[model samples]
Target: MKVKQKSICETCRKQKIPCDGTKPSCSQCRLRDLCCPGYQSDWIFVPHTAQSDRHSGATVVSQSGIVGGRKRIKDPRPNPKYQGARELTVPRVLGLSVSHLMTLIIRSYVPEPELASLDSNSNGANTYSQPRICGCWVEVLPNLIAKGETVALSSAVRAFAVSILSGGPMPIASLASGLEAYSVALRSLQRALRSACQFRDELAAAIMCILLAELLLPTTLNSWAAHLQGFGELMQLSGPELYTSGIGHKLFVGARPSLVILGFLSRKASFLGTDEWRCLPFGLQPPSAMQQLLSEAAVIPSILERLDKASGLPPRDRAIVDRESLHDFVAVLGRLGQWETYLQSADQYPLSWVKADAEEGAISCRWFNNITDANVLTHFWAFKVICLQNIDELAGNHPGMTSSSQFSTSFRERVGLSVMISQSIGYLMQDEMKLFGPSSVIMPLRTAYDTFRAGSSQCKVELRQCNEIISGILERGYHFVPLFFEAFRDAQFCPMSV
Candidate 1:
């Protein structure tokens, strides 16, 4: 017969106690304490066989609990809520990984003296930290301002380096791809990317785009590398400094010309003009006024006429005019009798070319010296007047009441246009400056500033309308993040797109 073996209580085996083995704890320990000693820390004990957990070599977890009996092991199964988490990894760029390329970029850009932050954070302590934007780990906006208070040259260089290492070079139409990659790469390292995502985030875009634009500009330059770097520099300025208020108009701000050109290029790329220009309906094309004039109730007739003709077309087909179309239209009138000359060579055209010539003309008596072209100025005014009229009377907001006469009418808008006409017309009279300059022919400013001015009639009527557009953009921006982390959580793997 087999030798009789004593029952080994799990509690006694776990606690190293002498056991007159019973069902749960040792009969001695339980009777004396009225509780099994190790059973109080039941999470640590494997039940059933007294020796079951001994061979596994896994440490037990102890939770505070009082147990009197040998309850079965409390094995709970995992639910769907706890399953299938995505693995985040450092994004790879080109052939090299993000970590490696960033090392290369930091190494290259750090060599510049104007860029001093390069060496200060050089210690391996915080070697690869990305700037905080907004929220949690996701996204890169080329806008730049969202990432930090000020754009530092070193950081700008680092971001550009990452963008280039990842995306190579991008056309103006698809610049966001590289930024997305930088966002992903940054998200996975040490910390999740985002402490703030706001209007400020545009700084990141501005910095990256400026760097990226530094690479793509100057079409005539045959050096591909030079072209790429040039475009990137322009993109970097899309930040609050250049893109913000009155300060953006400074001469030779570098990006001003390219942004003007980009507005043009983006306009050309959109088969349907959205932000830059509106189109006349095929059936109801406006021969008298290309765009509707301003009004309170009066302007509605023309707009309605245009809208009626356009309304029959699907909502998708309705053309909303924008900045580019206005500029292009201005260009058309500027070309005057020579309009065809510009059409074939729009791509080779940079705003700088036009501005440069205008400046030279003003400085030296050269092309377009005649200030007698009233027709060109008037046409320019017409485009602007119509643009202003469109800006007026958008009742998107209820900004209380005002005088009835204040209700903008096209005739009144023409009156408002007269204010701009006065301001711009005087520009041509500024010494011999216009003998060859841009502002010579009644001037070519990319503004309907008078129409938007607070004192102007259209601005009063359209203030709420403009604010609604601004607010709408803000509200829409809030949805940048998705509910499912998996959707953008994968950005860590592919930095080019978050």
Candidate 2:
């Protein structure tokens, strides 16, 4: 039989094998039992007519025996609407993204329920005021940054986020980016502050972001004070109108703890005690009983300031000042006692003894059990220690005399209180630690650590445990931990084993 010469089948061509060029199927496909994909016929050469003409590179013949070239059609481009259809979907806040980590850090400061609700809502707007609700900044900040609503505030948030991330085993690139963001944010904040009218909310938010950043990031001790001061100035400048809004209320409530700490550290009254704060509805209501205690505790600083001034005077002069300040001191103590009574009676935080197995012995630890309650109790005890320390100072007792057998009884009591506070702190959730921030625990822990006697085993053990907790906090990517650890070391009566 004569073999026909034809184009190779499509399947044979694709397989790069020779074809028998059969009409129905290729020999290779037939022999292998594979279905053949038929091939197109080869183009046939045709003689062109004299009347044919080229039009747009294509040959054509008119009815009048004139040939013209057909216009070449361009391939259609993809529709812009469907161009991104095949792209992989991603969350707005991916783990590596600065904004994503910021959202995590910010959410850490907020309650879980609020975070869940915020995640569920498309808009994430705060429609109502609830004590347990997460701050509006936590929900709104990521969106604001995404939308480029406020460059200064967004940069500040990014700076803060990157700084927190820098504490972890991050790439060198991330550390450089964090530094760049910090520089940009600081410069932007200065400009924003200069043009306050245009960037009121942005400026306020930036102040808060920077304040929190200062608290969490490695900085000079009490560097957050400047930001807190600026925040207060801005709030005063903006007036009550600012606090009336939902976001404003969230910002104020979220920042109140820092303000209280600043007040104590500065030995002055908290700005939250001002009439402007008093006038605002949200400001009038403390978020929790603990917050109220903090606000009330602001008076301690003012009283201490007076006592310190009085102690510096001549004996005759000091006696007059002391008598005059006596009434105020008594009233402040009375208020503090009332707070203690309320705390004792508060059913929300039930006290419990937690027994844990330790190397020394089976230690029974006293804690409120609840994280917030434990934090509050710890702070309260620290405050009491401060009160006692101050009272001791006012009574002409030398600082070095605390270890004397005569004063040893009170010293032991203080030491026991400090131990309990440290133990309570260990029970706090990682989320609570972030929410409260390092500033919340630093002073209390320092106060507790200061009560220790040099070379005392109990004191050394407590310091070691506190240091371990601080180390855990460091591992969690809080940059402030190392600074706090340094402060703890500086304040330690003697070198601790840990």
Candidate 3:
């Protein structure tokens, strides 16, 4: 029994590359160093016949025309009505814009079977594949878009998708498209807010998408902060109960870090500091290590709020406020320290702590296991810095409350933590880990920058380093970073030491 050969091999056909019509395997596959799965056997080949088909009125094209013996029609375009027998294919995203391509691709990327594979077992061992940040972008937004429940959400998602597809350092075209989509999303969101028509979950998801767009491609300095304020309002409307399960719960968990930052920006107590928010979002499940750390950090903003109020009081009243705030600050600092110790003691914390760098024969630095670890650790340090600096300020103002020696020690510890953040920059900016994006370091690095006075030598060094990282981030297409830098440049969030 003889078998018929195919015109192309499977590998070449899948790649959309030209295949040399070969029998066993194509030379293109060998040239490209790919294993050639031989041609599929399902196809039935039909040989050319000279006789005209009467059943379908099909006319066979001959090699030669009777006008001239053995003369072929070299160009077939003139015969517009004649169609080829072979199958014709085009690339999936060939004619669509980048944003459209992203929309279609992500929506279909994960099916039920693939999503189920993400459920890893105990001990952090996964027998199946999953994304690094599970269910946030790949799963959640796509699923929401699939439902088509809200236009606001779909538009916001397209805007975010464009940013991700750009892979940082977004081009002018993508930038314009993303901004246009973002504008549509913003308007749709406003309409949704006005009419009070969209479901709480859809509205919340749209707001989350808008917030991410601002972070990725912000038009104004306060856009991210402003959107965060709106997100806070929605959270209030839905209440903590709404976030106890499903998509609402995921958005709340994701928004926690941003809300904590919002507390710093507003210099006011945050809702996240309340017992309900701190404990309820996790529902029956306990908060993860990061979540617990975030809860501890959320308290710092309230301390700042109290400190602000205390500063405005009369001397007698100020003293009373100072003492209470001092105790609160010290306790917050202690809790943050405990969290740090516990994290460092965890097995996963030090996957491979090799020496990453040595600066001028002093102060060796270590790279973290991944961007997640480094980012979380730096954030922990930033929160501690805020608490320690505030404590130092309140104690110094009260003079008799804290000794000068103790103040100096607190000052030195905070400075050390700031330097530690700078040390982690090298690890965070690595190209390999860029999937985590440069947005992770924006708040933490900015916090690290505030630890030193404007004219101090240390301040100059940290400023230059931060500027370089910000430049790298922008070059990678996170254009909104400079806007954040400008907004935070003279921010009065922290009390600078003398």
Candidate 4:
């Protein structure tokens, strides 16, 4: 019996993906300059050739890696900086007597492969260095001028929201508890915003900014005379601290745009339910998952109440009309949906053990314990979008807010603004203020915008930088932060490179 010729490896046959085929080196292997498995009956192809010619190209021909006559010829590209990491350490902030700037601590963790694969020549270069101290720093956000020494010793009432969301290692309960811890800052920011709401135009803007300073100052590292005795402690607490900077520390205030952007982010964040899940794919999706997700926002009785009052909308489609309302409702639904699904069946992604251990009690078959990795990032990005929209609106000064009816107005109040504000402030907190409560998360944005009417250049820059950072992180998780750190440092310190 005569047997026909065997098929080539998919990678080699297509060349679109990696493949090895032929001779001692098949056509695919030869193309990649590898010792192909050679006519081996079992079409097994190693992903890459050991002797890779990828970087072996001579003078700029194949700058990355060149293949020549079964050899990986070393490319003669000049090494931009020798000693790899060490050489890259020269403070980009070289000569200028730059202030220490703001006291917020931002330490970036760079992801490899994705971040490393990027061209170092561009703003997307790879480097995950921790935050370094630079002599020159600038704080443009101003302190609110006050007389008589802010001596109001009023008894401050607090909102203590205890979230029993936690069931186990997924730590929903713990996170909820931690979130309540931040009520202190949230309440203060809220009070400031509400207080400013009672004030007139210019003063409102100023006071609104002063409250923004609570979040923004910590983010931008700005402080002043009212910051308390001595400089050392102030400098020490400068990074991400409210109302203070450290000794001989360089403090910087975020400009108007930065403040506005924070508000926008908060607005975006509000759309992502505190306990919801959202999945993002490249194409169209069945509406069931979406419908299921939208139902979760029912936890926020207010949105559901407004959605009900806007009674004319078809029951099924009611949650889908306005972006903010739709987003929040869906977000809440997805979270609840995820929990329900986890109880039914657990997915293999997120490297979770829900499948094996659910019956064993390591984690529950309940809602909070079944959180997926995909869900976490999904909510993260969703919030970013809401924030971005606000950023865009604020950047352009969204003046045409007039709607044909009161529905849009109600929608904005119920869900829109909250989502936008959360996104902005979320980005601003790259440090200790990491975990957040659903309500507290959206405070900065609402507070800032309810007070300030316009965006400033500083606010814009920070927003752009932050959005880029968030985008990077969403795409590549932790690694993206480092690249941003390098780009940010290079720009803020050296600047010429950016």
Candidate 5:
């Protein structure tokens, strides 16, 4: 029998070069003046199979000399390091992986400064330590989802992030996935609430997350109302105790804008008017001038609600209601004037109105010249406009309301104020669309757009500019911008006489 040739040295075989089968040293190695790497008895040459066979979804020897097959099953046991980790059974949605999805969600929801803080803090003593409550949903929650814990909340968070990523009008499949995730999250939340689970904070955070997802869904009005109401109730249930913690306080403050918007939309004062809600921290003492201004501004929504309810009464009843409301309206005007005076006097938050020539008209505008604090200025002016809008509504709609020259002058002044604020916002938004994302000033911009006199050519031009900025926001994946745009269009067609 012919003797089988000895296998080539391991190094030569690995290098895919011919190796003369020598016991002490291969000819290839000796010729190269290199140490002979020892050979294995089991070494054998194996050529790659046909492409068709390679992709048949079966095991094969890979190019790297390892046996390749379908993905291996992950171990079911919880990691000792991650005590509560659960393996997710629900398959990840196609296209993006879990880690990628988590990254996108974190970037979209978490503020840049807060994220930077998290990054800096990550290198501390415990690398795997849990982040604050504000971060828990975006950071720790993803890991929990990967381990298959809190599926509902995770699904909702994922759906919201995916919806945002899809931008514009979402694809049908993506919409379906979002809806399904939302459904799962809602049901899971209910179950957790009913059960005796120890993790109340997690559940509370989930409720907030679900609320965020609902907002992204651009859900029906009733659905949005329900989510807001549910969140309000959940926050109440958590009580004042929740606000005592640093994370809790941060979350509470962050949620204030949503609460204000929801309160305005629902025409409900109880959301913000409640003693419990008011007891929550507004700011550290001595409060910033901006904080003081916001605190006073927050009361305007309730006043508007009162005016709205009064407007719905019969002429006779409305006259009585209007008389009572007139006092409140005058009081509000006084308060607003006082705030404006305070804003003017406070050196800390200095504001000045500069006259500028616009294409449509000459307008007096107040904006923060400081680029960094422009958003604060936007909120300040926006709140002022909102207060003025309510005052205008109350003054114009009440049956007993006098059209006296005094009232007319007040009304004219209010109109001028609204115009100035709207134009200023338009200019600011135009300049800072990239700096402050579309959603940052969308509500206030929408309010300003709607409140501006529809018939004025100047107002119309300013409104068009605002719409362009909103459209830009829409192009950047804020689908909800269009809804507001549509509402503005409706307001234009059927202008609110009030």
Candidate 6:
């Protein structure tokens, strides 16, 4: 028979408060408004004694030594006053305070030079412990901090980190520290922006930091949009040439996904759609399959813009405009088709890059070689869905322009793409993928969820999986996802034009 171990929640236990044992959440924790890390009986306290230590044969204790300006006892075991002494329980997370942890995380970034051998030596490596933005922020920010380039970046990064680690409604202390750092970062950012020539790169990085923080702890609905606008302006100021190499290239690449989403949402043409912007950022480096995909996706906004313009025209003029838009849409669709074909035909995407797994129950999932590959695949599916939606919409609005067979084909493809997304959720929601995987899939998952008919069996199943993924995201400190989750939840259809 298993022994029933009684225990209080970790928070209450840490605080040394009396806990009225409860399931899910204890009364004390609920009263304090803390995100209580649930109950566990993993700890065992034993009175510190030579006899007990000898029996355990694990810990070695010195009989006498001066510690913290006090002469140690020869043997506290023999003293009645020290009879109740016990070993201190070490915290699972190594750090006395949030500030200390932040310092450790900031200092722990592996610069590019140091990370060189990682690829060769990374077999069975536990990369989960490394910082999330390894090649981008992790590579650049630490070096900048060391050189005293900017203090605000460091504080902003810390605030963002704290928000992620806390996982849910932050404790009072964690919230205070995060807000304090955030305030300091904002004030410093104001000064830096005023002197843009001196702190151009720093200004861009600082804005990114604010955007990241706003994702999880948003001040208002427009806060992220406002900050994103600033980032885009910074990009314009920096120009494509500036990002041709080094730290500039990394920053540009890091900021591209957000910029792409912004372009689509705004339904306006952007510089990202231009050939110069696509080719220049890579410089001497060969663009990855992901980069190539982004290049194709950037043109989507221009298509949306054309479609928007066509809608405002008179019927006769609209028909002419529709013909031009339809041609562009088909061209983009062909390009995406070629992209998919290239991935299969190219030597870069090895067979080992993706793995297929059997579904244990309701959740069917596939695993990828890494987070980047997973991101690329999900986004690919989403982009295809959007493109198809646009193509069908354009075709449908002007009758006889597009064949009925084309609509049937597009419908079939959309259904298949949604299934692919639903299956991939299992791997994407894993704890190890939290840093990059979860946030990257929000839009794709939303797109996938929208592909199905409402109240149908397929739609209900997809909705459940999406909800589970969103819950996992929130539980892992991606509080920003839920805000978007609510907005997408009730929507009957995706506004592809919007």
lDDT of 3 by residue, 1-498 (tens): 855436778777677788874423357975677767756666332332344232323322121110111111111111224344321111111223333333332332222233233223221112222222222333455345545656766666666554433223422223444565567688888898888843477777677767766555635556668788878877776678777766666667667777788788689898889888888877865666667788898877887898787777889998888899889988998998898888778765463354845667343454776545665778888888888888788877878988999988987787777778777766665544432435566667777766754325746665566555556655555465555554333452212111
**Lowest lDDT 10-mer window, candidate 1?**
130-139
Candidate 1: misplaced stretches above 4 Å? 1-157, 165-198, 201-331, 335-498
- Candidate 1 local lDDT, 263-321, one digit each (tens): 22222221112221222111132211111211111222233334445546654454342
User: How many residue pairs clash per model?
Assistant: 66, 2, 5, 78, 3, 0
Kindly list the per-residue Cα lDDT of model 6 for residues 81-157, writing each as its tens digit. 44554443222221123333333233222222223333233221112222222234434454345455456665566
* Residue 98 lDDT in candidate 6: 33
User: Whole-model lDDT for model 2 versus the true structure?
Assistant: 0.55
What's model 1's overall lDDT?
0.30
- When 3 and 5 are scored with lDDT, the better candidate is 3
Q: Each prediction's Cα lDDT score?
A: 0.30, 0.55, 0.59, 0.28, 0.51, 0.59
The list of candidate 6 runs beyond 4 A from truth reads 1-135, 165-173, 348-361, 453-460, 475-477, 486-498
* C-alpha-based local distance difference test score of model 4: 0.28
TM-scores for the candidates: 0.21, 0.65, 0.69, 0.21, 0.62, 0.70
The numbered model that scores best in TM-score is: 6
Error of 3 at 479 (Å): 3.0
lDDT of 1 at 291: 18
For lDDT, candidate 5 versus 6, the one ahead is: 6
Task: Name the TM-score of candidate 5.
Answer: 0.62
Q: Write candidate 2's Cα lDDT for 1-498 as tens digits.
A: 966445678787777789866533456886799977656655432333333323224322111111123321111112233232221111111123445445445544554434455545544434324332113445556555565556677678766655543332221123444455566688888887777664365566777766665554445555556767767766766666576645566666556666666666677765576555644635544456665566566667667667667767887787666655554545665677798888778665556555565446323345455545565677777777776555444444333423455345655667777777666655553343344434456667666666653325757766666666666655555445455444544764222212
TM-score of 1: 0.21
Assess the local accuracy of residue 40 in candidate 1 as a C-alpha lDDT between 0 and 100. 28
lDDT of 4 at 472: 38
